[model samples]
Target: MTLLSALFRNQEEVMTFHSRVKLSAYDRDLGLFIVANRDDKPSIKPLRPYQMLVLTTKVKVSDTRKWVEEVFKYRGNTELLQQFMEWEIPKFPVSGHMLKENGVPGGKRIGLVLNKLKEHWADSDFTASSEDLLKQIPTVLSELDIPITR
Candidate 1:
């Protein structure tokens, strides 16, 4: 069965994706508008290719209303989901439980490499997604209260 079918197998197992699309208006017929007039007349420049992004995911429909709600969970925005679609399902990131605190880099790409190393070192019984280990990361971060500046 398809992945979508699998995700929605039972209502209990289903994860809802509340997708939102915003498209800009473009006048396709405006061929002459491209010709720069010597008069320097202001013309409506067509918008670039419309951005297609999924705004949010929700277990309950109302969760999409405010993204910052305490318990709200979401999977991706448009760019994130687009990249996720391209990712190979077989390749899952490793949890960095086994690594030293110094091992995780300040950058995301380095962190990914560190995760790959963790995956390689994982034992037979150890699933890469150990919840106990995952929980520790945030706990440690919270203790440090590291400011994440965009």
Candidate 2:
């Protein structure tokens, strides 16, 4: 909520998808964005769960209704948003407990490792299993340059 509120820097009564600000926050955040020309022609891309975590992190829960309405209204197509409404990202198969048992130190490191694993999971289109993600722990940790106390 605070993220979204602080993001739209324009002084509008209601925050809109238009990039009134210099940066296109949606494209950076959700991989979805809109472009408008002087002719009032707008090209708006529908939302996608590129990073499953980003849906909640970037898009404000309270503004979901308004956000969906605005985007769909422009698109004149409701199917994608409908799918987004029904679709639920599966729970990550790997857990912090599993990481700990495998020698990952607790605290912020656990979250970093998990987030890296989740990136792999998302890359696999959310099909990676617990074992699959767990196998990548060492690689992910190395990529993150965390010391291998494991």
Task: Candidate 1: count the clashes.
Answer: 1
List ranges where model 2 is wrong by over 4 Å: 1-51, 54-77
Best by lDDT: 2
lDDT of each: 0.29, 0.56
Model 2: how large is the Cα RMSD against the reference? 8.7
lDDT of 1 by residue, 1-150 (tens): 122322333432322221222212111111111111111222242110011001212222232212211111122134533443453323233444433343333655335444333333233223446444444454344444443222
Task: Please provide TM-scores, in order, for all candidate models, with all chains considered together.
Answer: 0.18, 0.56
Candidate 1 residue pairs that clash: 53-78
Candidate 2 C-alpha error for residue 13, in Å = 10
